[model samples]
Each structure stands twice: as structure tokens, then as C-alpha cells.
Target chain A: MIEVVFFLVFFLFIFPFAISYVLASGKERLNIDLNYTRNPRYFSVSFREKLFKAIIKDSLLKGDSRIEVQMSKKELVKYGKFNDLTFNLYPNHIYVITNRAFRIKKGTAVKKEIYALYDLVIEDDCFIRAVACDGVCKIGNDVIIVRWIDAIKSLYIGSGCSLGIACSTEGILKLGKNNIFTRLYGHPIITYGFNEKEYKEFSTIIEKTIRENPVQLEGFEDKPVYVKGDIFSDDDIRLKNVIVEGTVFSFKNIYLENVIVGSPERRVSVIGERITFGRGVKIYGYIQANTKCGKVS
Target chain B: MAMGGIMILVLKGYIISVSLLCILYALRHLIFAYDRFMGKQKIFYGDIIDDQLPTVSVLVPMHNEEKVASNILSLLSKTDYPKNKYEVIPINDHSEDKTKEIIDEFAKRYDFIKPLHRYGGKRGKPAGLNDALKIAQGEIVLIFDADYLPPKGIVRELAVNFKDPLVGAVMGRVIPVNADKNLLTKLLDLERCGGYQVNQQSRYNLNLIPQYGGTVGGFRRDIVLETGGFNENVLAEDTELTYRMYVSGYKVVYANRAECWEEAPENWNVRARQVKRWSRGHNQVMFKYFFKVLKSPHLTFFQKFDGLLLLMVYLIPFLLLLGLFDFLILFFLGDINFIAPVYVMLIPLLFSGFGNFAPFYEIAVGAVIDGLEKRVRLLPFLIFNFVFYSIYISLGFWQAILDSIKGKKEIHWDKTERFRDKGAAD
Candidate 1:
């Protein structure tokens, strides 16, 4: 009886496998690689033929008119001119929270802290792209950048610039000699980005930190979460219904009383190391520190 | 009792087959969720830095869009793409209201906003796009539904993806502008987050096939025309384009930066009809592309595998329907014991119900990544989304199959009933 049951289970399992094997064309027999970020497009044909099929035919050969590559910043601006349009990160003006000028770059590096693009105006409906160090950001002919990052009142880039690369988006950027590139047709891209090596270091640091100092949050529920005396949390602090009145810091995320700043009729003030309000919570003063919110006055 | 036992034994084989398929589907989503978590923060804003921006034709297919036409036209006019390089073609697909009048006014106001009125022709977005392509002079054809409001620089952002010699088509993320309107839109906000933020973004990050969603995306006019414009008969011309582009050895780039706002259906019935139409269109594309995807040498093994899974996405509900039949048969025969948890889970019902929660992980991850936990707390309500999808998608699948077998001409493209005219909820 046990043998018959085993046979039934085995047959049932194999039935699906058999069908899948046949239907899948079996060409994808490679072991499943968990590393998703490392994929290179593989063409079935030769490079020459594939290039002709992809670039020449798709682009319609208008790109053949290429001038000699020059490294001067003048050449950069001369090639790609910026249009007069501008994006606003802040409602009325752009703000800079950084103690130093924020520089954007491409490549990977180990860093203590970094951020995705913040405090910059982007009125455009847009998202950021992942650009490798060797890659070029091609702002097509007649295409132009909106005058500036809307939030960053002082942000300026002469060439079409790549924003902080995808891999590293936190802390102070530290670019190495090998991280620089010159053949691109955009703003000379700058800023130290994170790669696999930096990512490994980050994983180790985060793991070690979490292990050494475990978080405790049982007491901060339901009641007003007025963060005081330099509150630091790696995770989000979810609170509701009451007012919050203290300085709080979180390395990851924080969800607090949603401060809805609709129509910049009145300036509301709140001090946040790095904060984002939920929605609808009223505010009375202007935010004093570097802050990011869903809606603000 | 003997006869009942015989019936259970006979049906067990089919049930086992269906169960394994469910497991496969669940496993596929598991990988997607994990990938999304590892890299949900990544976005793709396409960039182009050249002096000569290619001529682009922005195609807006409208049906009774009088209420929203002017707003969208104004937004398009504001885009920073060189005015001379791009033209706006707003095709008025036989609207009963004053949509034509509004579009004509815009056409008169801006030399670029040329309005095309379709009187007596095949009705549907694909049909309209095909007709407009003949008159469109741009090298690239960018499409936006009448409801979409694209931000400044979106045109150039998408056009930049073509800088990569291989990119034949490009797609961008879609954000629901009226996401905070109602419960339906709120949940749809989560759905869209998972669909675009996690699903599409991760697919692009992994260099896998990121689908070219119809709106906020564009294709090389020459390539699309050379290969025959949008398939008028195919409901999901976007899905068809993704498959056809892949099979034809051209790549589709997903631009994270080209984010555009769109209005999602605000009510359950509208949402249900919208999902039904999608499922039906997707299933037809699947049937057409299944073999072609498998045989395409340009696609890597994993790409082919991913494509196959995509083809089966619409069929999940049908499999659940079959499982329901199995349960009914078992219940009528008084062999209820045949559907023990172990057997039932492996069969078709497993993923459709429990495995449906896979998207929850993505939505939660998306919410966490975006720092929107309030919505994450509302994750349980996704069961409503699942229930609606399972029922309607199954009906759509069966209906599409029946239509195909009967040689139905399939002309009317049902538009999702708009709720934009109605004020948003408080």
C-alpha cells in the first residue's frame, strides 16, 4: 500500500515536469541564477549582423553624423544645449540641506550614508535610471534638461549629467580615479556610486549593527510618538491620532502624523533629520531641518 | 461507494496536473517578489544627450474625452521636447459627445495638435493608431491615452532610450493621479505600484523582458510600420508589441524616469470591466505568441521561460475555474474526501487563493520602499481585488476563446467607464 502511494505521488509530480519540459523548448536548461542584477543581452547571431539589425535599422542611420570626441566642458555644452524649462522640488523654491555641495557621479563605492535624489525639484513626470560607469547618458539632439533640480535651489550642471547612480544613493559621495569617464556625450557624470563591493560592505555593516543593537518598539504604539532626545530608529515609526513634538532620526524609514501642507498660504515649521509626512495632519510652522514629505507648503 | 471511489481515482490524475501548474505559477511570483525587494528602489529615467532629437508623433486616442481633453492637450504642449520635432495626433474615435469639438479647437490653437476624426471604420485604439501612423511623419510614434497626463521632459526621456542602438520600443512607469480618490483607486494604487514599481522595474533591472505598456511608451515608427502597425484585432496590442519586438530581435527598454500620471477606475464595476477586457486581450496575445516566444533565439533561456510564464498569466483564472468544476464533481459524487487540503492545494485552487497573496508581499515591499505604510496596512483588502480578477478574468478568457473559435471580427474596443467627471472622494 505504501509503495502504491509513493508511486502515485511520484507519477503526479513527474507529470507536470514532463509537460513543462516538453513545452518549454528545454533550451533554458541553465541553473537558476539568483543574481538578477547581472544580465547581458545574448544574441543568437554574430555581432556584425546583430548590430546592423538593431542599431542601423532601428535608428534609421540618422546617428551616423558624429563629430570627433572632445574632452573640454565647452564641447559638452555646445553639443547638448539645455532648454529654459525648470522643475521645482519645493513648492516655491529649492532648498539645500547638505553642508557641502551635492555632487552626482557614476560607479560603486563603500560609503557610510547615501540618499536617493532628494530636495530637488522635478516637476516632470519622471523616474531615475540605473547607469553603469562605462555607460553614456545620451541626451538626444534637440532634447534638453528642465533648467534644474526643482528642490535644489543652487543645483547646476553644465553638461547633461547623470544623477547619483542607482547602486549608491546615500551619504557623502566618494569617487575614485577609476570611476571617471570621458567619451560620453552628456554632462561629465560625477559622484561616487555603489557597486557590488560597496553593497557587500553595506550588508556587513547593517547586519553587524542590527546584531549589536536590536530594536525595541513595543511601548511606542497607539500613543503620540513625540520623538525627543535624539531618537534613532532603523525602521519606520508608525503613529496616529495624536500630535508629535520632538526631533527623530531614522536610517531607513519613518511614518508619522501625516502633515498635509496644502496651498502654501501659511508656512508650517517642523524639525526633521529626514522626514516624510503621511497626509492630512495639520502643521503650523515651517520645517526647520532637511525634510522630505509627500505634500508640503 | 465503489462507483464513487472509481470516479475519484479517475479524476485524481487531472487534478494533480492542475496542482503542479499552480505551484509553478506561485514559484514564478516568488522570484519576482524577491527581485523586487532586492531592487525596488531602482528607477529607469531614460536619457538622451544629442543635438538632433528625432521627430516624434505623440498619438492620443480619445473617446468622449471632452471633460479631460483640454487638460491633457495643455500638458502635452508644456512638454520640453522641441516643438518642431514632435506633433500631437489626438484621434477622436467616434465619441457621441463634444470630444471632437474640443480636439478640433486644440488642433486650431496648436499647429502640432492635429485632430483626426474616425467616422466609419474599425473601432479600437489599435485601429485608430494604425490609421494615424500613415499620416504621422515622426520617426518614433509615442502613444498616450486621452486620460494620461505626461510630465515635462517625458517625451525626451523616452526618446533617449532609442540612443541604445538596440531599443526598438520603450515603456515608462504609470502613477494613478487620482489614487487617493476612493477605496477602489487606493487599492488600485497598490496594484499599480506592484505592477510597475516591482514587476516592471525589476524585470528591467534584471535585463529581462520589461513589457512595453501601451501608454507612456513609444516605438520606432519605421520598425512598427515595417513590421505592420499595431495588431487591430489583438486587444492587448502592447503585449503583442512586446512579444513581436522580442521575436524580431529588437529590444524594449523600460524607462523608470518617464513616469506619467493616469486616472484609474474608481468603482468596482468599472474596475471589473477594465480587468475583464485586459484579461481577454492578454489571453489572445498569449495564444498567438506562446510558440513564437519559445522559438525566438534572440531571447535567452530565462527570457523565453519568463515569456512563457507571461503567456500563462491570464490562464490562471481559467485553471481555477476548472478546479471549481473538479470540486463540484467531487461534492456531487459524495467523495468530498478526495479534496483534502493536500490534494486541493497542489491542484488549481492553490495559487489563485493562497498564492494570490504573493502580490501582497510586492505591494508591502513597494509601500515600504516608497514609505507608504498606511496603504500597506490596507493590504488585506487585496482579496477583493483577487476575487474580482479571478471571476472576471476567467469569464474573459472563456469568452475570448469562444469568440476566436467562432471567427468573431472583434471590432468594438470597450473603453473603461471614466469616473474622472465625478468628484474624488474626501
Candidate 2:
């Protein structure tokens, strides 16, 4: 028993040390592989030549496309440049690539906000409305508007789209290109679902409207829409003057009044006043419109 | 019947000896736990509110340390302390390579750096330090080896503790930076943590003067000169000076917070050389001053006892070995039974487990977490650290015994290899 104890004690201290020593020595031999060295002189020459030729080619193809601007504290502006370029703003810089290909290296931080206006080859074609804004704002690539009808913030109206009177979108609003609306009469508010409880009391008014004119909401059935109260993404997305919201996956010619339209998945909601449909509405979720009919007979 | 009785007596003696060793090992663990884990050692960065910030001279003694010399200079330049209040005096003790050239480049770039080139190869680090001490203009002299990369706030931290007039020396914690590089570095890191975190902290808490580690230590320039600078003849100048400071009625305090990272030996060959030097130096100091410490008029009885204990710590591994051998004899004779006292093994096992594995795991986890969180690439190396370290430390112990037995007392300065960008201004 004593011998066993002795052996254990000896092995405990000595064995670990011996193994470590051998491993360390072996590692020393292996560490040579970690040292990476290329022919620096040859590589440098080739790199410099390639860089010079690329710069010359870029300048010949594009006009002097460099934009320089100074930005003060909290200043925001939009640029409409379509060339390979660099912009050195005060305290920060923004670069836009409108030609061939550009790569933003990983592990590098660009300390400025950038808005890519046009779809270059690398970036996908999508309407980026209010890409950088923190205030009540309206942004569009098309259409002009008059005052008092309600300026829209948080509503993303894409190219060649128009909004009618008495319509207001407050929460996250994403619109696809060439979608038009005719005379939206009430505030269509979209908000987070958790905060929907506070607005649920007001939802009784909507319920009452549906009960009173149940026949008017016929064509609004099964349309994809979002309720104002759902945890959209990670954060609770809330909007005022827009109680309910939904996404229209397929394009439809429609008109209706004071009703909520939602998707089958219940992920999107649309609340509007007096929506009309020119053709048959193929809906996905719950939709409530003022009146549903095949024709006005 | 008489012959059987004689055999039984011998067997019983062997069993008793083994039992005593096991008990001692167990007790050592208990003391280690009480001292290291539950010990009331505060590791906070103290305030440096004093109006007068004294100029500090960082003396780096180098011998063929070309590899790491550039890195040391670069790190020194980036120190968060005021540039005007500090000067780096890198004493190049006849480096055979481009160490002088590297120091010269740094001197040209930074006015605070002065390269003190010694022509002939010095026998050891003390000679180089002594040469640099002549022109050292700082009120406080901080010593760092070529391989050390002191953290930004270290100088200020060490400076704040010197407010106590009676304090002769302040020892900073030296940690292994390349701990994940291999098993050897990992073990060295653990050993360092145990020494700096546990042993040194315990001694400091108990108000006992702990030995100042060579690197990551500071001393009052006046006080160092008063004691005739460093003893060049002694193998371990740091240990010898620490004892001398105690004899002069000055306090040696260990600052657990002020940290500097050092490179551990990458290979066993370098590890063996470094360990042999440390062992020989420690032995020399013990032999030279153990009795002197006891008889000194300045030392208290408690201090004398502590010093003696400190000196005897070097012998623990050897004693443990002997104790194991003595236990083995009785076990083979069948005088002692294992089942009766199974709990005895638990004590040493538990103690050794914590003492060995805790620091290793802590450092490995720390490296991994830091790497994952902070994006430092050295995190993956933690896995192999344990196996590498055990080898280095065990070899160190073996080398210590071998050197002592062979009377190899030559002061050979083993230089660590550096892995920083050479062309950089640092």
C-alpha cells in the first residue's frame, strides 16, 4: 500500500513534467512551419505595377469622380454620383463604387454613413428608403406632393408610386416599385404586438365597424396584412396613425375603406380607409374592406 | 519468532515514515489553499495622487538579446506614463548580433531612449546593470528584462506604492505572455501565478519581506546605491538585494496588481538553461544569507523564521521525493493497509489538483475568452499549455538538483528569442 502511494505521488508530479518537456521540444521543431516568408522584393514589384495600371485604367474610363465635402455635427445629405470615386468628408470619409467591382475588406471599419443610390453589379436592386435618417422624413425617387394631406415618415414608397389623400403610415412601411393607391381616407397605423394591448381598446372601434358593415368587407377576405402590434424582427416596431399593417406579396388593383388586411402567416398587416379593387383579390390572410363586390351593380 | 518480530519492526518503521510524508503533503496543500485561494490579498490598482512624479529610469540589461531587444524598446516607448518622466537605458552587454543597431535606431527616433553599449561580453546580467547604473538619472530605477512587455499603467502603479518612505523595493507580478505557445510556457505561467499570486501575496499580507523577482521589480535609486548597488558576485542579485534591503530595516512589498508580461522559454533546451541558472542563483543566495538573515539586528524573529522558511521552500520537491521513497519501502513489506485510510490520498490529491490544474485552467480559459472576445489569435494554444509546462518545470527541478550537485555556479545569461516586427519604430 505504501509502495502504491509512493508510486502514485512520484508519477503525479514527475510524469506530467516529463511529458510536457517532450511535447515542448517537439513543438519547437514544429514552430518552424509557422514562419511564412515570401520573396518580398518580387512580390512588391508586381503589386506596384498592377496597382498603377489599375489606377490608369480607372481614370481613363471615368471622369474625375472624386467628391469632397465637409460635414458638421449631425449634418446629413444625399449624393447622386455614378462613377468610381472617393469622398473625403471632414472627420470621416465615404466611398462609392459605381464601376466594375469593389470589395469592402473585412475587419475594417468605415466611420461614416454610406448610401448607394444605384444598383452597381455587386449590390442587389432594392429600394433603400430612409437608409440613413433619424427624424420625421419622407424619401422617394419619384412623385411630388402638396401640403396638409399628411407628410409620411416610415413609409417606403418605391419608384413611380403615388399616395392618395388622408393616408398616413407611421411604423415600418416597405413598398415595392410601381404600386399606386387611390384616396386613402384614414390613418393606417402599424405598431409592435406587445404594445397592441394598449391599442386593443381602440381596436373595438375597428371591430364595431366590421360588425356594422360586414357585407362591405366581402372582397377583403384572406389578404396578407400586419397588425400594428407584433414584435417585428428583434425590436418592437411601432407607428402612429397606422393601427394595423400587412405585406402585399402579390400585386393587385384594389380600393377599400377603414379596414384591416393581413397575411395568412399573420406576419404582415395593412390598415387603410376605403380600399377598392378593380380586379379579383387573391388574398392570403384576413382582410376587411368597406365593401366587397364583383361589380357595382 | 524473533526473526519474524525483527522483520515486522522494520516494516512498521517504513509504514510510519510513509504515513508522515503523506500527512506533510496534505498539510502543504491546506496551507497553500489557505494562503492562495482564501488569502486576503487585494489586487487593486492603487491611486497615484502624489503631486511630484519622480523620473524613473528603466534599466534593461541585455546579453546577446538582439531578438527581443527591439520589442522591449517598442513596448517601452508606448508606456502610458509621461515620456519626460521616464528614460529607457537599454544596456547592450556585447550582443553579437544587431541588438546594438536596433537600440541605435530607437535612440535616433526617441530622445528618451539612450543605448548604453558595452564592448566586451559581460559574464552576467548584474555586470550590465551595474554599468547602466552609473548614468541612470531617475530617482526610481525599474528593472525589466529584454523579454518583458510591461503593461501601460505598470510604471505609474509601481510609482504610487513608493509613497511609503520605509519601502525599499516593490515587486510587480510577472506573467507569461506566450503561455499558449506551448505546454512549457503554460506550466511556467501557472508556476509564476502560484509564486506571484499565492506565495508572494501571502508573504506581503503577513508583512513578511518576500524576495523581489529580478524582472518586474522597482527600487529607490538612492537605496540601491546605499546598499552598494547590486552584488555582482552573487548569482541571484535580486534575491541578495532583497535580503540586504531587509537587513537595512527597509520593507519589501509585493504589488499584486502591477503586471508585466514575460516570454517563457519556447523549447526545453532553453528552459533547462534558464531553470538551472535560477536554481543555482537561488541556492547561492540561500547559502550566502540564510544565517546572516537570522543574526541580523534589523530582522524580527518572525521575519527570520519567514526568511528561513522561504529559503527551505527550494528543498520541498526533494523532500517530497525522499518521503515517497520511504513510504514505498513499508508498503512493499505489507505493514500498512491502503483501505484503512483511503482519505489520506484525498488531501494531497486535492491540493495538487488545485495547485496544478486551477491556474492552468484559469490561464487557458482567460486566453480563450480574451481571444474570442477581443480577437487575439493566441487563444487556441491554451490546450497544449499544460503538457508543455509540466515538462519545463520538472526539467527545471531536475536541472536545479544537477547544478547544485555539480557545483556549477557560473552566471550564464540565457537570452529569450523575440517575435516582434524588426523594421517597426518600436
CAPRI accuracy category, model 2: incorrect
Write one digit per residue (lDDT tens) for candidate 2, span A1-297.
667776775566566555545544422110111112211122223322443344345433554444433333433232334333333342253343332333222222234443332222112222222122222223343332221112223444344433322223323433334434432211222211212222233422232111111222222222312243211111112222222333321112223222343433342322222333322222222222222211100
Could you estimate the TM-score for every candidate?
A: 0.60, 0.51
Candidate 2: residue B389 lDDT (0-100) = 36
Q: Which candidate achieves the best lDDT against the true structure? A: 1
Q: Candidate 1 chain A, which ten residues in sequence have the lowest lDDT sum?
A: A203-212
Best by TM-score: 1
Clashes of 1: 54
Deviating ranges (above 4 Å) for candidate 1: A1-297, B1-7, B39-45, B336-358, B422-426
- What are the fnat scores of the candidates, in the order listed? 0.00, 0.00
Tens digits of per-residue lDDT for model 1 on B43-133? 2323223334579999999888876787788778877788899899999998998888888888888898887899888888999999999
lDDT of 2 at B147: 78
Each prediction's Cα lDDT score? 0.56, 0.51
